[model samples]
Structure formats: C-alpha cells, structure tokens
Target: MNSAVSFFYFLSFLTILSAVMVVVSRNPIHSVLYLILTFFTLSGHYILLNAQFLAAVNIIVYAGAIMVLFLFVIMFLNMKQDQEESKTNLTKIAATIVGGTVFVILFGAYRKTAIEPFNPQTYDSQIGMIESLGHMLFRDYLLPFELASILLLVAMVGAVLLGKREIGERHF
Candidate 1:
C-alpha cells in the first residue's frame, strides 16, 4: 500500500483507540486527556486529508483551548473517583440493545448511500488551504460563524455566572 494510505490507517486506529479510552476511562481527568488525544489524532487525519488549516484549527480549538477549559472545570469541581452503581440490570440491557440498534441502523444507512471513491490524483488540487477555506467561511458561512462566536460568548458568560457564589445578603 501507499505511504498515504498507511498513514491514514495508522491515524484512524489512533483516533478510534483514543475515543474508546475517553469513554472507558474511570477517572474524569483521564477521560478528558483521552479526548484530547482523540482530537489530536483527528487533527492528524485532517492533515493527511490535505486540510492543514483544519488540522491546525482542530488542535488549537479542540485540543488546546476546549480541553484546557474542560480541565479547569474538572479541577474546580474537585470530583472524587467513586464507584458508580448501575441503575439496574434491565436498564443496562435496554441501553445496550438501543445502542446496538442505532449503530446497525447508521451502518446500514451509510452502506446504502453511494459514496464517491477517493482518487489520489485529485490531491494535486489545493482544496483545503487556508485561503480557499477563508473564502468559503467568509462568503458562504459568515452568518453561522458569527452565530457560533455569539454562542461561545454566551456559554462563557453562563459558566461564570453558574460558578459565582453569592457572598452578601440579597438586596430588594
């Protein structure tokens, strides 16, 4: 196989493994760390797909900034590692059945769709460069981009408000 294909497989494996670790890890900190690793692996996959800008943004936004915020919240909460009791065996069985059903349905839907086969020769085109992405984001996705910034601002404000503790008597 070609080097590109080999790299893609390796990155895919790393991403999947890290994602699984994120969910399976007992400690919340370890889960967050695994999630960061998964994001980094996903960034590598984006780089392999010739999306350098996307890869850098993924690392900056998800792996760096978002993960830092998550870590801070986790630390602030000072949660302890405790053995969580399962609700019931029936509940576990039901959840497993539902999850399996959803997975099968999604897989079947994906298989039914006509996916365009990848052609390595098409890699010559600079499709995922910063300039091209900037153009599209500014022209086609400007509204959504602005909305996302607004959403993030709201979330930041909400987090601060939620974390603030009342220190004085209530005023009329």
Candidate 2:
C-alpha cells in the first residue's frame, strides 16, 4: 500500500485502540489519558483530510481544555480505584456481540460509500485558512457564535452557583 493508505490505517488503529481503552480502563485517569490519545488521533485524521484548522481546534479545545477540566473534576471528586465489580460472563459476552455487530454494520456502510481520493483542484484550499474561516464566521455565523458565547457564560454562572456551598450546611 502507498504511504497515505498505510498512514490512514495506522491512525485508524490507534484511534480505535485508544477509544476502546478509554471505555475499558478501570481507572478514571487512565480513561482520560486514553481519551486524550483518541483526540490526538482524530486530529491527525483531520489533518490528513486537509482540515488543519479543525485539527488545531480539536487539539486545543478537546485535548487540552476539556481534558484538563475532566482531570480537575476527577481530582476534585477525590476518586480512588476500587475492586468492586460485578460483571458476569454472560453480560460480557452479550456486550461483545453487540459491539461486534455494530462494528460490522458501520464497516459495511463505509465500504458501500466507496470514498474517492482527495482532489485539490475540485476543493477550495482557502476554505480551511484562517482568513476564510474568519470571514465565514463573522458574515454567516455571527449570530450563532455570539449566542454560543452567551450560553457558555450562562453555563459558567450555573456551575458557580451549583458549586457554591450553602450558608447553613455543616461540614464534617
């Protein structure tokens, strides 16, 4: 296979492995780490698809900011690893069967799509550049962008309110 195809397969394997580890790992921290790896692999895929801006945003927003917040929350909760698990063999078998079935279905769908190779001439290379992105954001998506910021501010206020200790509460 050519390097592009080989690289695609390698990234696909890494992304799948990390995603599975994220769900299967017992420790929350390990899961978070796996999630970060998954995000990185996805960013690599975005880069391969010539979406450099998306790759940068994915790394900065999800891998950096969101994962840090997740780590902080996990630490704040003071979670410790425990050995209390009760999954039976039957449950494991069923879950595996279901997961395998879904994977097969998705793979079949992907095969049917028969995606074509990238063509630079047919695509607008400038679309992914910062200037084009900024123009699109301000001209077309300005209202939605401003609303999203407002929603985020509201969420921050809500989080602060929820985290605030009650005046009448007693601590041990």
Candidate 3:
C-alpha cells in the first residue's frame, strides 16, 4: 500500500493496542501511560486527516495538561494494587449480553447512514486552521464550548475531592 495508508494503519494499530492495554493493565500508572499513548496515536490520526488544530489541541490538552493532572491525582492518592476479585459466571454472562446488545445497536445505527466520498480539491482547508477554529468556537459554538469547560472543571473538582485524604486515615 501507499505510505500514507501504511502510516494510517500503523497509527490505528498503536491506538487500538494502547486502548486495550489501558483497560487490561493491572497497575494504574501503567494504564495511565497507555492512555497517553492512545491519545498520541489519536492526535496522529487527526494530523493525517488534515485537522491540524484538532491534533494540536489533542496533544496539548489531553497529553500535556489532562494527563499531568491525572498523574498528579494518581500520585497524590497513593493508590495501591487492587485486590483480586472474581466475577460470578452469571455476572459475566450478563455483562457480555449487555455489551453485545449495545454493539449491535450501534452497528445498526451507523449502517443506516451513508458515508460521503472524500474530495480533497473541494475541501476547505482553512476550516481546520486555528483562527477559523477559534472563531467558530467563540462565535457559533460559544455555549457548548463554555459548557464543556464547566464540565471539565467539575470533573477536576471531583478528582480533587476523591484524592483528598480523610482525617485520621493511615497512610500505609
């Protein structure tokens, strides 16, 4: 295949592998690292799609800032390896059924929609520029943008609360 296609596949593989690792890793620190790798791979995909602004934000916001905060919270909490727990067979079966149902529903929903062919010549390259993205975010999507920021703030506050130690608790 062409170089671009090959690179896309490589990024996709890395993204999927890291995402799975994030889910399966026993150590929280290792999971967070894998999650960062997944974010980097996603940013690479955005670059390949020619959404430079998105790629930059993905790296700066997710990999740079959010991950730092996540790591800080993890360290501050002084988390330990979780105790092993086994799920009953019925619980596992129920989870699998629920997951399969959700997957089938999502697949059917997307299958009904038609994908448009890509046309590079007619694409508005300026649309993905920082200036244009800023204008759209501030002018057209101001409410949604502000809402997202508020949501992020609430999440951070929640994280801090969760990480805060209770009085008289042993550090161990």
Candidate 4:
C-alpha cells in the first residue's frame, strides 16, 4: 500500500482508539485528554482532505476552546475532592514532544503531497474561503442555517430552565 493510505489508516486507528478511550476512561481528566486526542485526529483527517481551514478551526475551536470547557466542568465537579495523582514533569514533557512530532510528521506529509490544479471551467477559486462560506451559508443554505440557530437557541433555553434553582434553594 502507498504511504498515504498507510498514514490514513494510522490516523483512523488513532481517532477510533482515542474516541473509545474517551468513553471508557473512569477518570474525568483522562477522558478529556482522550477527547482532545480524538479532536486532533479529526483535524488530521480534514487536512488529508485538503481542508486546511477546517482543520485549523477544529484544532482551535474543538481541541482548544471546547476541551478547556470540558476541563473546566471536570475541575468544577471535582473541586471538593483532592487530586489523587499527578504525572511527573518528565512524563508531561515526553508527551508534549511526542505530540509535536506527530504534528510535524502530518504537516510534512501534507506539504509533500501534490495539489490538483484548479480548472476555472469546473472550479471556483473562492470555494473554501470565509467570504464564500458565509455567502453560501446565508444564500443557498439559509433555511438550514436558520433552523440550526433555532435549535441551538431552544437547547440553550432548555439548559437555562434545567439549571434554574428553586426560589428558596440555598446557594452554595
């Protein structure tokens, strides 16, 4: 098999394994770590598909912001309990180095791959940019976009209602 296929399989395996670990892990921190790994793998898949913007957004939004949100919730829930274990600095540094190495490898692979030249007859150069994305979303997919916003608004309202405390409940 070609190197591209092999790398694709490797990333797919890592994504699946990390996703499963996110569910199976007993420790909240461990599950969050696995979930972050899963996001990184998904970003790799987006890169392989030539969607660099989506890959960056996945890393920034999902792996960065959303992971922080998850960690925040976990820490909030565990505030009453003492942390049982902490890995050594050496372990943390090793993990960082390994993750960086994997990122570099994937970037190198992406760089070495040839991009298909665009044909003006069949391709729009503005295909993946933010402006085009916004235009298409607002124009062609307006109904679906509005429906998604309404759905999110409903969910947010439901969450607020569910989390609302009773009138006489003690704040603590």
Clashes of each: 0, 0, 0, 0
Candidate 1 residue pairs in clash (backbone atoms < 3 Å): none
* Candidate 3 lDDT tens digits, 1-172: 9999999999999999999999889887889999999999999998887789899889999999999999989878776665434556888899999989999999999999999887989978788778888999999999999999999999999999999999999898
Specify the poorest-scoring 10-residue window by lDDT in model 1: 78-87
Q: Which stretches of candidate 2 lie over 4 Å from their true place?
A: 75-82, 85-120, 165-172
TM-score top scorer: 1
Tens digit of lDDT per residue, candidate 2, span 138-161? 999999999999999999999999
What's model 4's overall lDDT? 0.88
Ranking by lDDT: 3, 2, 1, 4
Candidate 4 regions with alpha-carbon error over 4 angstroms: 79-132, 153-172
- Find the 10 residues in a row with the least total lDDT in model 3: 79-88
Per-model TM values vs. the true structure: 0.75, 0.70, 0.71, 0.56
Q: Which residue pairs show collisions in model 4?
A: none
Judged by whole-model lDDT over C-alpha atoms, candidate 2 comes out at 0.90
Global lDDT of each candidate = 0.89, 0.90, 0.91, 0.88
Superposed on all Cα atoms, the candidates' RMSDs to the truth, in angstroms, are: 3.8, 3.9, 4.5, 11.8
Candidate 1, residues 69-94: lDDT per residue as tens digits?
99999989776666455547999899
